[model samples]
Target: IIQGYGLTESSGSVASTVGPEESKAYGSVGKLASHLQAKIVDPSTGEALGPGQRGELWVRGPLVMKGYVGDDKATAETVDSEGWLKTGDLCYFNEDGFLYIVDRLKELIKYKGYQVPPAELEHILQSHPEIADAAVIGYPDEDAGQLPMAFIVRQPGSNLTRQQVIDYVAKHVAPYKKVRRVAFVNAIPKSPAGKILRRELVQQALSMGASKL
Candidate 1:
């Protein structure tokens, strides 16, 4: 099935692809809908990015919700003065006009100034023969800013060492993207839709004294 993208603030879909021609492009969420206007902007600088540059996505249109109920502060933060809603999603568009969602801006690991996508490392961790599932999170670190931490669920009866997991990720990714800490768990927290409950893991890490890392 072709994947489409939308949000509650937009009130409905802001982009979708239809027809056989559009469906064949793997990983694309399709093109932007005609009525809405969209732009990509650097999260830190707020400078608008051109097509093919990965950045935060912002959209504005009649369908976009005016503001969040009862919370003017949140409304102000989310919807800008120009009526654009900051989707807080990292994305990029190809030359063919197909949009691809990368990951959430809030979930990205800021390691020493480089932005590392946790999903990329998590994919490689899950590919290991002794791993069943995995999740990646950024643990607070004074020297490096934030270090990537891996929470894994091993294959039943499999015993994996911390160094083994860390080495596997280091081999696949750059130095900035390597998994620095490891935690083995039975299962990963998830929503009903099977989305990783990242916030819960963040809380877990903090409670377990992640600040020292």
Candidate 2:
């Protein structure tokens, strides 16, 4: 199937795979549409990044909305004065100009000074044979801004331990991106659309006390 990317603010899709040939790029959402200008910028520094560098995606085009209806404040925040609409999505482009969305910018976890994507950790966790499902969240920390915490559901009849879960993720990720905390749960909280309700998990974690887990 052809992959594409867009939002309501952009009126519709601003990029899409042309055909089966371009769709072979795997995770890419193809190239930018005509009349659309796109750029990837370092989220922290706002510096325009080159290919293979992950950053926030900005788009400018005639199709983009002038403003957010009556919300001037929201409009000013999303679309800059120069007409570049901040997509608020962490993404990167391949050398061929194909866009790959990593995750939502706001969902990123700050561990030490490094930005860790929860989706990355969740992917690794779910790959384990003992793990039936998983969701990752940023656990609050004093020294580090946030730590990667996992809420896991084990496979039927599996007897997985917290240390085993932690070790499994540590082997597959960088030191900073390691899953430092884990809690076994019956099932992961998800919305009707199957999107993980991370905010609910965060509130549950806070109520249970981080130290206890």
Candidate 3:
């Protein structure tokens, strides 16, 4: 499948599948264009990571946006002094240099100081025949710092139970990654581009006094 990575801020795609030979690689956004430079860096330390090491993706190229209009603070936060735009996306490159997007760095769930990627749980939840869609967020917990919580949309006529949801994830992931809280909803809020509106769900969970699963 043809795939590319781009954002409105970048004007358009800076990387895409080049040809039939490159299109054979699965789960990649293809190689970067000649004029563009990209790197995967440790989000906390800014240290560059090697291929196959997942980290925050950064890009610097003519295609990158100059700055946000009339928003110096936002611009400063996004574009570093070296002109590299912090994409906020977690990704890694394969040995063949194909880029693979993971999940958003900001959306990672922290449980007992361990970082848990919400997308990993969401993916597993969606794989269940009884679940149509899912979104995962970290809810504040005094002890664990944050607890992984899931907002699920069940398949039509499916009678999935909360225990089943917890058990399913528990069996698939490490003990720390199991979803501890769950809320079933009619639908998951998403953007026009189909991106999960995680912030909205986080707020909704808080307003509903989100509790244990």
Candidate 4:
């Protein structure tokens, strides 16, 4: 895929991934272009994280934007004095050095101090035998802070049921990563570019919280 990088103050996505082969690397956003410099930083302390470690993605270089149009505080929070843009994205680099997007920094769920990634559950759901598509979102919880919930679209004419989907993911993933709730819909709502609309799915999960199936 052709790749691009950008900053919040300058603009979104300064560099973009292009070409057929580059776009197929679903694990990562893509390689950096000549004009950009990207770094993965430790979210906990703002330290630069090494390859293969989960952290926030940061960028600088030519493709970087100028600065805030009006809001200095907002600009300051995102861009440091040295001009490095603090991207709120959560991701890691593969062994081959391609970037792998995991989740947003704020969307990461803390389950009793253990971080639970919603995207991982979605991947597991998509792998299920009867699921055509799936979306997982974090829901507020009294104790865990946030819990993993799933929404799925079954394969056409497939006989799988809600409990079956839940059991399937539960059996394969760690308990903390298991789908606590499941909802089967006619289709998985998505953006025009094909990203799952997590906000809507989270609302649907809340509405179906009391239902067994």
**Backbone clashes per model, in order?**
0, 0, 0, 14
Query: Comparing 2 and 4 by TM-score, which wins?
Result: 2
Between prediction 1 and prediction 4, which has the larger lDDT? 1
Model 1 sits at a Cα RMSD from the real structure of 2.2
Each model's RMSD to truth, in Å?
2.2, 1.4, 1.7, 3.1
- lDDT for 115 in candidate 3 is 88
Worst 10 residues of 2 by lDDT: 204-213
Which portions of model 4 show Cα errors greater than 4 Å? 1-26
Instruction: State the TM-score for model 1.
Output: 0.90
* Positional deviation of residue 137's Cα in model 1 after best superposition, in angstroms: 0.6
- Whole-structure CA lDDT of model 3: 0.90
Per-residue lDDT of candidate 1, residues 1-213 (tens digit): 777999989999988889878988888899999889999999889999888999999999999999999999999999999999999999988888889998999999999999999888988998999999999998888998988999999998898988999998989988889999988888999999999998898888888774443
List lDDT for all candidates, in order. Answer: 0.91, 0.91, 0.90, 0.76
Worst 10 residues of 4 by lDDT: 1-10
Q: How does each model score on TM-score?
A: 0.90, 0.94, 0.92, 0.82
lDDT score for residue 145 of model 2:
88
lDDT tens per residue, model 4, 1-213: 355545454455644557887777775667665566778998788898888899988878764665777988878888788778877888777676577778877777777777888778888888977889888777778888777777788899898877788788888888888777677789888999798788887777777766543
Question: Candidate 3 on 92-208: residue-level lDDT in tens?
Answer: 999888998888888888899888999999989999999999999998899999999999999999999988999999999999999999999999999998999988998898888
On lDDT, the candidate that comes out on top is 2
Check candidate 1 and list the clashing pairs.
none
